[model samples]
Target: MSPPRRSELEMRKELVRLRMEMQRQQLDYHAEPLRHPLRQLGHLFAPGRAARGKGTPLAFGGVLLLTLFGKRLGRFGKLARFALEVYPLVSAGLRQYRESRPPKPPQAPPKPQA
Candidate 1:
């Protein structure tokens, strides 16, 4: 196969430069929303709608299986009880995350003295 010509290399470099400039412009355009006074103020308010009754079908099926097998196997009852105990922990972590402050950029690491 023939080697690429000098013009082809120049064209490729120009294409890459154009692509990078387009990305930079797009980022700046999208970032304008965060700079808006209304958007900054609105972020302070609580988010709308608490998540509830949003269980998957698998969860419902597990509950049904537990209820059905609880009498015959007894293990199902224990499994159900364990799940009940863990539910509060899962919800508490979720609630804490929902109410937590926005993440900040990481600070530079401290330089070691010579």
Candidate 2:
């Protein structure tokens, strides 16, 4: 006799269980440093890839640093947002200024050769 097929609910439950298992494994891997005293130093020197996404290391570091220091640097976020808001206006004014400037007089052509 053929085995009974799983119901949709059963499949979803199995998926949830698998996801929980994967998350536990990831947590265990990331927390491994706490198991050994020197491992934390190694972690600092050679950061683990377990928590990294597919993004470049620079992007990941930016995201990590931002999350870590964002509250302390909240003023900078406001400053950055203000700069972004003003950039187009400033650039447009600069462009207009450049465009409105009179062209420099052209140098007279070199005297024709004898």
Top TM-score model? 1
TM-score of candidate 2 to 2 decimals: 0.34
lDDT values of the candidates? 0.63, 0.61
**Considering only N, C-alpha and C atoms within 3 Å, which residue pairs clash in candidate 2?**
none
Per-residue lDDT of candidate 2, residues 1-114 (tens digit)? 999999999999999999999999998874564466465434434534333322345544544454445446778955654654455466667778888999899999899888
Q: Which predicted model would earn the best lDDT? A: 1
Flag regions of model 1 displaced more than 4 Å: 1-53, 84-89, 104-114
Write down the worst ten-residue block by lDDT for model 1: 44-53
> Stretches of candidate 2 above 4 Å error?
40-114
| lDDT for each residue of candidate 1 in 1-114, tens digit (9 for 90 to 100) | 999667988999999999999999998875665467466335323253124324445554654565445446577678785884466467667868877968788999999999
Global lDDT of model 1: 0.63
